[model samples]
Target: MKKTFGLLNEEEQELLNQLVEGMTKEQLLWTSGYLAGKSEKDKKTIKKERPDMPNIQVLYGTHSGNSEVISEKLLQSAKNNGLDMKISLMEKFEYRNTPLLQNLIIIVSTHGEGEPPSNAMGFLDFLRDKDTPEMPGLHFAVLGLGDSTYANFSQAGVDFHKALKKLKAQPIMPVRKCDAEFMPEAQKWMDQIINHFSGTSVVLRPEKADIPAGGPVLNGVANAGFTVPSFKRVYDRNNPFYARILKKKLLNGDGSDKEVYHFELSIRDSGFTYQPGDTLSIVGDNPPSLVEAILDKFSFGRDEEVVLDKQMFTLYHALRNYLEITVINPVILDRYNRFAGSKELTDLINDPVQLADYLYGSDVLDLLTDFPAKLNAQELVSVLRKLPPRKYSIASSFDAHPGEAHITVAAVRFEKKERIREGAISTFVVDRVKEGDRIPVFVQNKKKFKMPEDKSIPIIMIGPGTGIAPFRAFIQQRKHDGIKKGTWLFFGDQHEKTDFLYGDEWNKLKAEGYLQKLDLAFSRDQDEKIYVQHRLLQKSEKVWKWLQKGASIYVCGDKKKMATDVHLALLDIVRNEGKMDINTAKQYLNSLASDNRYQKDVY
Candidate 1:
């Protein structure tokens, strides 16, 4: 920690310490950003003459495109308000040196465990460098976007805020944070910006001050000062449409050891359309049995009233429909351990390696069953995070089935502590959801993962198991579009007869000459187990030739092993077939990635 006395006056230091006491690093970052804006507004409000027209430089760091959406909205709002401003994505921002701007606004989202989004890595490195430029004249505001479930929520924003503060950048306002339901909060912050520039004092909205946790009551009478955002065309994540399931059939034959399913949902008249590279997001709820078990552990009744955000719900309803209970991260665990006062958990939390191991396998149920805590209904609800939605690659093309959407799912069932433990969504679909049942869903665009515009260009797809979902859509769309481009697919699974997903479709496509190559690597079919990576090595010369002829590559599947192995295989192919060294081959693949000719959609 910095020396409080040297940095600020006694009064200011006391306020800072009080605001940050018990806050996580991510929360502190949000506080810093919020303070920057408030401080700048206070400092400039007393000035007799206002500065010249604001030329704002807005920067966005995003994962899954949320931050970019927020940035664009702000940019459009600035234009509408007659403000001169420009926005740049963090990856595209010139990162060779630190940028010095007079007025800036940063909208960044953190992903994983407090790491910057993929696009912001290089830009963050530049800011962290010792030789970064000072910003004495710069006035800035920060707004962090992130999920509260993860341990390092909004961590990237915190890093940037701290770095800029060290360089002497003055804050225009304090760092503000918003959860997934960010539009209302974002709109309020935008209004504050407009008022600040107009030399108007910020108004303390009533709802911001008075609304309780959970959410406002269903009637929405208590949320007086907040304006709920609306959409024009169709449903989205905020308002998903219930699409009925037309079919749910297992792709793997009997006795296959794997249980992969192919589902077709009827989107007829819902206005929900999807592209080949898009994803279908489904919001899942906690299992009632699990929720009841936790309630039993706490000795809490189902009828107990619990509040969240400003809305009220019964303890049972909230646990089943809203809160996440499957995973326990560091932040949530710390709070639980504190409540339980368990020295063992406290010791484990202090050690980084052991804490990670515990978090990996331990869910809320595990935590409670092992070291029970005696938190009230309200306190228990407060410690847990809202359940986030699950995303799956859409396996059907709208061109072929305009009124339907398809997805492939692999059921995750395992034995834990002599009891069956199933994945939240995977098992929910397999066991509970019926053929005629309706599921809430929304489509997410994957523009970069789409097909090439030039129909004649050859394409190579490496999708093993459920990763083949999107590739099925691509090939279907190609057949529908009558594109005669050479398509090569490398698919692998356990056994040839049982695990070959979309087997009939590939055969039909090949017969029609739409597919030029179909390579299969069924590991258990022969003595030695083989995978797609090994198959790629066997076809090294052919793979290199396709790349030489301007073939684009797509990889979709497991990131841990398959993605890494396929990437290595590409490097090896480039080295041996192209007669280049390992480093040169690596650079060549990187160039393809930079140009968006190579794309990935792995989970």
Candidate 2:
């Protein structure tokens, strides 16, 4: 009788593996089936020792917390299916482990200007680097979120998809990129990803698993800090303390054609203390006339009770206090058109150009009048974005103007088809609100837009129109601190006499030697438009010398054209005066941006 492999004890089993070296499967089969006479039952036992499900990992990169919400949903789906799943922020995960990942899913969001969100920087660097692993066994899917207004929309997602393909990882599902309003598309993409892994044993039912074991309960106290006896003051958008308006003066001179306002808000006992470069964000109500027009079109009683996000309030209150009714976006049009049931609206919603035309030409109130849609309170709130604060440059320094905040605002008033269109917050601050009227306000911290920490360094400011707001604060701060550095300001507008905002202030600063240089280019004062860029070129020698002496450049204005032109002008100076190639000049400018020497606050 011959010793059989299956019948051997544990010690014999270890010895058999050593005897089987260089033996092929055919040789083993022939030895077992004929020479060894092994039973068929032993062969079936070896086949059972394999993993039940494949290993998978999910990663997310997020900004403003939205991507994390989607990741939670994905994780919950994985949990229900009984799959071995893991989640991590892409930045912290080791890229060297990429070769071991069999199934992977990435959820990411793009920031402004098509840059990857701050959290994704490290992960992106590793993926783009040449040292990354060749992961042929891996399969991946990506979901990207971004805003469409940016020129390079979803560039990070596009790069990730391409990089994964280059590494030979099969796509588990097609990459899905969504805009700011991303719910429906995200849901659809998630469904497709779930379907791809359908054979996995684990299944997640979100509705059943989402709720905790205990019944709904109040978990925390409302207004925790307000419980203190000394915390008597209540500051909120709905109920704001009346701060006396100390000044409401026009900044432009008699001959000046632009209308700019310098406003002072008394913050005495308001508990608001802001630095020189901070922004004061105001929560403003929509113009009353616009609200009334919307109500009339919808035929809803103003007193009708409506609930929004579990809060009960009158329809009028919800519209005026909680919802955005002035700024229009595509998602708003998409949902409203469905509710409107009008042929014109239906066609407009389907046509992208028409939708854009509608958004450009009309506010939300205008849509209500043109195509009335009946909406219950909840339905209305569902379609609207929460009212966000309008940020204004804090034009007064705490050291200079104690107990008060100042802002320079260009009141936006226009006529569309002979109908007046008022800017919601600008008009509220400038025209409607009275002295002693309370305005809900908060500070928006600006880290990037700030004056040089070392006051002795020279500074150049280019601000036109109402873009002069932050520069005013900068000047006020420099004056208070008695900074001896050279301060050059390049101010421009429509005309010299009437449109020259803060003319007296700039004149005084110049006379006091606080302003080393005050260059003005009133476009309409001359026959040809003499803008800021032309003035920059006019003083290129001095500007180039200042740059050599380590002066930090700052620009605050319209981003669409003026900012671009000003940037180009700086590049021209680098190329012509600094004698650098175009590429080198660009690199120099980028270096300035990264080092915080170049700063911009443009809308």
Candidate 3:
């Protein structure tokens, strides 16, 4: 058949045969449609019939899937406007084809610190390298997504834009950087690009605020909020399911320095189903004390009407439920300074180090106290960002406990500037919420941190402190599947007696021979502090063997310290045990990451 067709090679023919051998009729139909779409896209790329309507493509890099979502929206908008557009992952784009592209739209999110998302690293490296040729013909636009709290806000997108400019690519529009409340801005950016490609002028409407039934609005326009449809209903950040708490228990002992709680929520009949690696996003209100303090400090009327998402809400309710108040970021600081006109605050905003120092452990009340702005309720509310949902690693598997979701939360309490402060959501869950109370909730699927589908593959999990949340779900999932012979876990905390979360469960699993290897590191149990990284180093030989046998490694925990330490330890292990040099070992680890054998879900 290969010779008769004069097309596919022997290996390709064999692969195609194997692929189609077990495919159902529906699968075959879907595959045919996908191929046809690809063929049409290829034809458009090669045959440019119109000079004005250049072939356009979208490339995205995402950590939380937001970039991909925006890219999809752009693709749909282009299609609606009778334009041909192909969308791809940044990692999948070949650098060699850079000069061939006509128009490129990049939607990317910055990952930890200032780094590009994992998928964008390769493409970013290619762009930064000296060997890469210039692409004078490429016209592009970039949209960046990030939290303004980070020092390097929208840094990945900034880097891409800068690199493309250095390579002499013409830009269709200046890069747009959006904060967590990115929907309205993202929609506008998409509309601009669609209009540009369709040769249509943008229509500007008059600014007029009106309440909408869907949600609130700000600045005389809807927030462009939308809902995702589920089995029976739609839900999203704008419209979330109110899940009743089934149970809540403090996991820490009396003498423990930390306060950790395990919560189980009933999602029964809510049309929410999640896998082990998914996250549960909780919409929590600001602490009443903090809200009252802010109102008192500003002497603002609680009953004053304020606009949010185009809907009018009482200032009290807006501060309590709809806006962020407990934390401060550069974006908020900049906005507030506009009202306060504080020169000192302006200086701090311009200095990254000073800004970081000021932002740490600070809240809205702190901002008000320091600046002493004479702003009204509406002005104050306008300065604050929307209340983003707090997402936690799901701690229980749906297979193990149907119609329920579980999460582990560690209360964040600290003393700063001679004032006691706490995390908004953590404190809300621990202090304000009671069992049977319905909390607004949604599920965020983490595609990058999923377990390998091949259950027989050996797996090593390294999670310490609250990072152990998803690992618990992984174990529960393995137990439910009744295939847990090749599992290894390294967990640590401050002390084994008080802070060893789920100690009894681990012991039971160990005794039952389901948990093949269990390593514990209690940082304060000994003279010197030891973490999961130390444990990983101690088991270097076995770890190397597991890696050789194709084991997947999962790390979940604090990104600033634990995740960094564990990553370095893994590199050292590969260098020492694999008998390779530093660069080669680094490459080996990169290969593992590329294959999805190494995954991290750190905050």
Each prediction's whole-model lDDT (CA): 0.76, 0.72, 0.83
Q: Summarize candidate 1's per-residue lDDT along 1-603 as a digit string, tens digits.
A: 455588697788998789779999899889889878776533222332334424687888875667776777777667666677778887787553234356778888875457676577667777777866666777888888876545566778888888778878888888887665566677788777766665443332222322122232212222233432333435666666566778999999877998899999887777777778898987656665678788886788898999976778898878876777876677777878778999998998899788777776567888888887778889888988776667889999899989999999898777677755666677666766778766667787754577788878889999999999999998998889887568999999999899999899898898888887899999999999999999999999999999999999999999769988998999999999989998899889877865667877766
Candidate 3 residue runs with Cα over 4 Å from true position:
1-54, 199-231
lDDT by residue for model 3 (1-603), tens:
445335787878788899899899999999999988776434213432444343997899987778887888777777777887989898888655665778988899988887887788888888888877677778999999988877889999999999999988999999999887677778788889988999753433223322233223211122233332344655566567767788999999989999999999988878788888899988777777888887886678898999987788899888887788878898899889889898988888899788888898899989989888788888888899987778899999999999999999999889888878878789878887778666678787776788899999989999999989998999999998898689999999999989999999999998887788999999999999998999999999999999999999999989888989999999999999999999999999998987889988888
Per-model C-alpha RMSD = 15.1, 13.6, 9.1
| Decoy 3 TM-score against native | 0.86
Worst 10 residues of 1 by lDDT: 214-223
The RMSD (Cα, Å) of candidate 1 is 15.1
Q: What is the lDDT of candidate 3?
A: 0.83
- The model with the greatest TM-score is 3
TM-scores for the candidates: 0.78, 0.67, 0.86
Ordering by TM-score? 3, 1, 2
Angstrom error of the Cα, residue 294, model 3: value is: 1.0
**Candidate 1: which stretches are off by over 4 Å?**
1-54, 76-83, 91-100, 108-136, 139-233
